[model samples]
Target: MQMSNRIKEIIEVILNSKGYVTIGEIAKQINVSDRTVYREIPEVTEIMREYGVQLNTVSKKGMAAVGSLEDMKSLRISLGMEKQIYIVDPRERIDFILLYLLQQDDYIKTEALAIDHHTSVPTVRNDLKKVKEQLGVYDLHLIQKKGEGILLTGSEIEKNALMINILLNHADEATLYQWLRREGDVSNPFTKRMEEYGYLDVMSACYLRMKNIIRDQCELPAMIKDREYLEYILLIAMMIGCHQKGQPYEKVFETENFKGEEQRVTRQVKRELEEEFHILLSQEEEQYIKWVLHMGMIQDTSSVYTVKNRILDSKIHTFIEYVEDRMGLQLIRDKELKESLYVHIERALTRIRSGMCISNPLIEDVKKDYEELFGIIREGADRIFQDDFFPDDEIGYLVLYFAVSLDKVMKRSFRILVVCSGGMGSSKMLAHRVEQEIPEICVSKEVSLVGFGQENLDEYDLILSTIPLYIDKRNYLKVSPLLSSNELEQIHEAIKRHKYKTMRKITVREQERRQLESRDNIESLETLRLLMDTGLRVIRQFRIVETREKDLKNNLLRILSEESLCSLPETEEKMKKQQSYYIPVTDMVYYEAVLARMPEPKLFAAHYHDDQYLSNGEKYTDVIYAVYPDQASEYEKNILNRMLESVIEDRDIQEMIHRADEKGVRQWFGYQFKQYLAELLAV
Candidate 1:
């Protein structure tokens, strides 16, 4: 960690540059000798690693930092170069100073704060004045405790929000994620910085330990999937995880209100907090968990509203209409979905009014998973609440409401056969897992390896076999007996294959196609949606379901063809007919689709790569990716056409396709996506 000034300068230069730089170039820029530059290279590399940066060297191509933009942002904080990099200015320092004061249990001496920040006492006093003004924003206050130095006061939740805000303002998503990963690892470079940010080692570790315990010992609902949100609530558990000396003056919690599931989560969480962190959760802390999980805690909606729904009926209806228009889905009519959204908004508004800021750990996941829908709801909320910008956490709840509602109406479930090894114990366990985890797929029968041969495989739309089969088939995936995350992903993709296949069949019916074709003036976005109607969407993730010695490429191509996106035969014929066009792009593994789009091509390709290698080193895995392009606008062709060309050349394009929110994925194929991608990719 003791790096020379020259070495630090080299890192700063390399980090600032997007492309690689030669050693000679680096030495010349820094005005150092070639030998000095060479000598410092090792130290520079060590420095980068110590600061969470991976220096990528392309041999003769020279070196540059290889990581996300968030990593680079974290690097500034890691090295204490935040000041040098202008990562946080004086005005921002005041905000952090305020957060520090708020977290103080007793009055913190103003002189001590000044010394800590390397500023003079008067400057610290001036900072406290500004801090007071800033706390006013969260409806909090700075007060002088009698017989103590200086105290900052706020409601417990508001104080917690200030702490969370301070942490988030300095740390990016990658930093927050690394903080969790660094838990219990004392030697971690991030550990020192995390403590510097006010998280005690025992407390932070307790949050993560509790998470693993819950996953192993209990079954959690799907809505409880966000890791950040989990950690935030656990942070609450950590805060409340201390020995209590006295009882509450008044009991507000009605134990009768907690259904079986809420009671289960509360009991397990309470026991773990006591054993792991040594603090029995007070009733208030128990209530915190229930409040945090309200989105998931509401078990039955069968109860008639004894109280008028928390949110205004008219406001919910208007918001629903806006969502329907933007998303092109009917949500307003779904009574169940409307009620769900209503209760969430009502509870959220009540919390917001009380200065209680709840964090959504899965906000990133939700945004990544449902980008466009999130955007529409965000816009809708802004319209409804003219005075305030809705928090992302609230918007995340809306995403959950609509995603579940839409999936209920849009999804078409398929029956699958579970083919396991001869052991009934393992096969039945796998079958139970498939039923429990994958609600979308219904298992029709559980058959053994020997029994599978005798049973009618064609009766089931998809087959999941644990062992290799002699049968050559399309809708099949070979998984392990354990059924890990990797296998779950496989099951997910297989289900998509059947769903898209069915959608393709229903959409391409002569009647629907004829009616669809008659509309010529469709918006580019509408045309994009039309592709979904034509079954043109790619499976979000591709799985290696193909057997060895099989023509995986052809089988995968046939699957993509089933989507009606494009036909391999049709694209090949067009390649022969066209005089000139850009070459097609493929990763040769995950990207098995044809990416070359003509100015007025019939369809955009979206296929999966199989597990076999042809002479050219390409294989199809599961579904064929071909698109039957309808009449798209010049704008649509121009944007998506560019994405197809870029997808072949850029790794980020490939990744962003997988990781980006729905709108982000759709926009990537367009010229606009490239513009936005460049700005964020460096981070």
Candidate 2:
């Protein structure tokens, strides 16, 4: 078998190591399986033997190098390890083209690029096609002028977003900080380190200097919440600063989004930035800064799920129920699924409201992979929403959320190995606590540090260690022996990290065509993006009521009379008509736990008139009303029923009644009926 480049690296590590290292250790370092190492070891050994350097395998210890020091030195020379030349992968030439264009004042010839990379001009043209594909993701298009040259033209926000993606993709936590700390040229080792993450080179040192200046001069408002977001804002700042050296100010094209207080905040930020950097800001630069503060840093929406909880909850229920009926999957009981799908709905609503046109890079892959699921989500959304407006990208996200949950639901129990200290006292305590605290951890094996060496590391999904170990890796955890609050939190974080790591590894394998396909991998990534997004569409419709009407029955009848479409004064009479045409099933859901646990006392009521009711000659307008002095909680979000069905139990449904007017009641009733169709279809 032909030895791969990775195998060659492994040979170097084995040969240079002072002591024997196990295949597990090497595999962990390389982010592969021990079986892969085993497969390649023989080939590496054959290559090593040609230089008279022997590969020695110790039974339980691992592998070692046994040969003359000069012979080993000669082997390194033969492999060109001394001055390794980086041959950029074909997949990464696109990034090179992008970075190359970013630094240019005008479009350089494609032939120049081909010569720089020592490739044919046609190859450079092909690379440009891929560059266009990538730019399309950021909503920026490549402008190939007939005679002048090629360039990128888009809103400054879009440009900043793309630059941030390229600059951050190659670096880890340490290297990112390194660039921020050092003030020198950033000689990124792309071909050696960032082969998996696309290779591109930009003057990161200059950018980081701007970042440091920005940080030192101003205190960013809390609205600039995340580090990644702050970085994007700084990139925009750098671009503006770079352009400002020649022109004191530049005029920005789009100013409609920036007005009044937003414009003022933008000016203040610009003044502060200019003073710190000793530069002057133009009207355009000020407006661009306003764009960063408003859209990039400050929130465009209230918060994720800040909308009427019951309305969102109802939508989530309808989505899940519809998906269940269509896909034949039992999804209602999956709390994690419900949480994720609910978040997707919340973020989707927020994105729509914010008017931010974002595209999913994997939309094509999602459409191709889970065509049926995507259709089910779109169809289900239409059935649930009055005017469903999910873009294909949004639908892709929804499919991913559901697909990942389904994949997990279909997945079997995963095992974890717990490696403790040599002494059993603390390790046993931790082991027992781990078993008790984390019920999701289905299976576990307890072993000492030395005993861990005997265990097949591949068989277990994770390794939980109480003490620090020499070989730390993905799916490995180090925790305090006591399993304290912090330790438990670590366990929680470790689980999440392990999940993403596993998903990423699986995706890499699948994308490389090594594996057939893992729906879980793609879905996991989609779910990850939704989990990261924060914002929600805000609506204020809930009402509070206080009157002599203390009785639940009286309130129900009075609200029905005021809100019902049929003008039926008597709810009893309306019920009789509904019974004749439609069966009214009422569920009394208790909010004892919800009410007692509510942080604030917020009471509201809502009523929905069944669309089917008042159809023909029916005198009854089907309306359901519930009253509660509490906020809309998750359990109470959706009242699952047909015409004239009432739920007095859920916090959200009950809370809607307190402040519900005729219009609000009627609107809510439409949502309830949509969900009703989902439950009806299942039966």
Q: Following a full C-alpha superposition, what root-mean-square deviation does model 1 have from the true structure?
A: 16.6
Per-model TM-score, in order, reads: 0.41, 0.41
What is the per-residue lDDT of model 2 for residues 1-683, given as tens digits with 9 covering 90 to 100?
35578877788668545468899988987888889998888788988898787888989999987666467757777766645433366654566567556555567777787776667999889889878876644556778877776877765555545555555544444545434444221234432232222221223433444455445435444445454354544455555545644633343445574437656655555665666566676677666565555554443333434554778887788779877765555778887777767655765664455443444646768998776567667777777875646667678878888877766653333566778779766667777787788765643678898887888777765667887776623236777766788667756664564454444323322232211123366764453333222100101222333334433345544544553343435443433211112211121211111222223222234233322233333222222332322454321232211212332322233334433443454455556544543432333
Error (Å) of candidate 1 at residue 229 is 3.6
Please report the TM-score between candidate 1 and the true structure.
Answer: 0.41
Q: What is the lDDT of residue 354 in candidate 1?
A: 44
Where's the lowest-lDDT run of ten residues in candidate 2?
531-540
Name model 1 segments beyond 4 Å from true: 1-3, 10-95, 105-115, 118-139, 144-150, 168-174, 180-198, 217-221, 241-258, 295-315, 321-347, 353-355, 359-683
Which candidate has the top score in lDDT? 1
Cα RMSDs, all models = 16.6, 24.0
The lDDT for every candidate, in the order shown, is 0.57, 0.54
